[model samples]
Target chain A: MTDWDGRRWHDMGGQAAGPVPMESHDFALWEKRVDALMVLCGQKGLFTVDGLRRALEDMGEEAFETYSYYERWIAAVNQNLIEAGVYATEELAARMAEIAARGPTYGEAQDG
Target chain B: MPHDHPDHDHDHHDHDHDHDHGPFHHEGMSPSGHPYRHDNDSPLTYWQRMEIAVRELLIDKGRITAAEIANQIEAMDARSPTNGAAVVARAWTDPAFKARLLHDASAASREMGFDIGPLNLIAVENTADTHNLIVCTLCSCYPRNLLGLPPDWYKTRAYRTRAVREPRAVLREFGLDLPANTTVRVHDSTADMRYLVLPARPAGTDTLTERELAALVTRDSMIGTGLPLRP
Candidate 1:
């Protein structure tokens, strides 16, 4: 309860957060990997966990709720990577474009 | 995938709308053997694509080896709720261990041979007069070393916002109907520290062994959404 910034959304203590369901679903393969990726990056001195939290905090509100849990992790890690000079933003865009051009290959491959 | 960062400052960065993508396919870019989940909309998700490029680029730059990343992944895979369950079970049977757990949770975990990572771990005991609930209202700042990654429900908007403001009601909805006189204390994990709820030992388990008692400790019990089973 102490040291919470009143204006921050994440500092929500004793706020009307939402309903707490008693169950949880299985984490998808990619979703499970994000933790390790982040830990590895952190262990390499690339960025701190606090830095990653800042990046997550910096995300747009809609984006915060829009993507799945690890999707946000991927975005936050990507942001930190580019900011840390470990990867170029331009390269990321280029690679994304390259894969996008491949045109959803899984369906076609599965059919063949 | 929806993070279209407004600060993405590139004059030529119309990476979104450019449709005249070339028919070029890099030699090793075959979809058949790539490390990707089969999403119908796109073979490789935006995040998967980014991971590949960033992972490769980091490797190319001599920043991190693929082995280290693999090792970390293996470590994460090895972690589970059993780590927390063992800790809680020991505290339930042994009063001295319970004192140590409440005093310094991470050290107590380390004493039990569980690596609790770098963040401080605090064990808040739930007593008859007081109940403790943990939440990371911002993001899912869980004690992964103890309980692994948080369950999907823990990261939901409702849980994040409601855990602090309406804990009693939220807990009730989770099937934890507390006594009206019990004061609920919702711990907000704002920083690096993570909180674990050492739920009150249920009655009639005095004869149960540590391993047998650990079986009664559910993941939600440690999260304070539910209580340990009564045996």
Candidate 2:
């Protein structure tokens, strides 16, 4: 698949070849893709909210807190995207509310 | 009393050397022109601090073992370089591969035996007539599975600020000056997905093996500020 610029994508070992343009709407598509991946992985119990909390504790309070700030910043960006009509407003609001209800607990409201 | 004064003077001189600065002339200066103070601002919020404390309490209560945590770090380190190299090699050898990567990066990466997650979100963008740069505007939400720990600058506020507003200028600062015809695309990696640039391979690498090509692709190149290694 070529990107918008019309470059071709080859598989590993340089053996396969095809043309596909990258979507102009990649950011929106990626968000949807990740949301799906999160559900799939969450169902498999690979990345649990509680597990992340424990991991943060192991990394120490300073690092964990910095990570939390990072999460908040991303959430704000998602909110902006929703405002810009880049994301679904209803979904964004629901997610934001869910995060808020988690009450700033370990790995509760924080996941990018 | 007079003898004590001399002794005190010597003691003060010793203290000055011990602090690694001569007798202080300015509150913020240490003989060097640079400020001698470190900013101690806590980057975390109050709630985050409380959460960390609570989590630690849980761990102490036997919820998780410290060894299990160490294992994660070991796993991450092992995964980082290989994933990075694979992406670089694929980009170098296959144009179609590069296209796929730019289209659906995570899936493409997985096909190469690499996982692009807890942040499975991936976006691939390309620039030829112009250059594109990537920065995690919020924090360093990098493709760590592919790239190792992001360089210090990637995580710095200076880079985040300049990368968006003045991308071309920032690239120049990194010693990457594109042709005037090149348009600069600056991507702010936010919540939905993160991005990695598919840098064009450098010349004179036609005969190199895939492994050798991978070695030439540095993390900075994927970030779009540096070129692949030469020779």
- Per-model clash counts, in order, read 10, 15
- When only the first chain is scored, the TM-scores of the models are 0.79, 0.25
lDDT of 1 by residue, B126-214 (tens): 98898898998877888889987776677777788788777888887987899899988888885578999999999998899999999
Tell me the tens digit of each residue's lDDT in model 2 across B1-231: 100111112111111211111221223322212332211121323433332332233234454333443343344434544466678688668888877876788878887877666565454444457566888654455666677545546655456556776677677777788888888877777534677777667789899888888888766777888777786
Best by lDDT: 1
lDDT of each: 0.71, 0.48
lDDT per residue (tens digit) for residues A1-112 in model 2: 7444432211011122222111111011112222222233244444543333233334443442344232332333333333434336565444445545654432233322
User: How far out, in Å, is residue B5 in model 2?
Assistant: 38
Off by over 4 Å in 1: A1-6, A13-18, A21-23, A98-112, B1-42
Using TM-score as the measure, the top candidate is 1
DockQ of every model listed?
0.31, 0.03
Off by over 4 Å in 2: A1-112, B1-56, B121-127
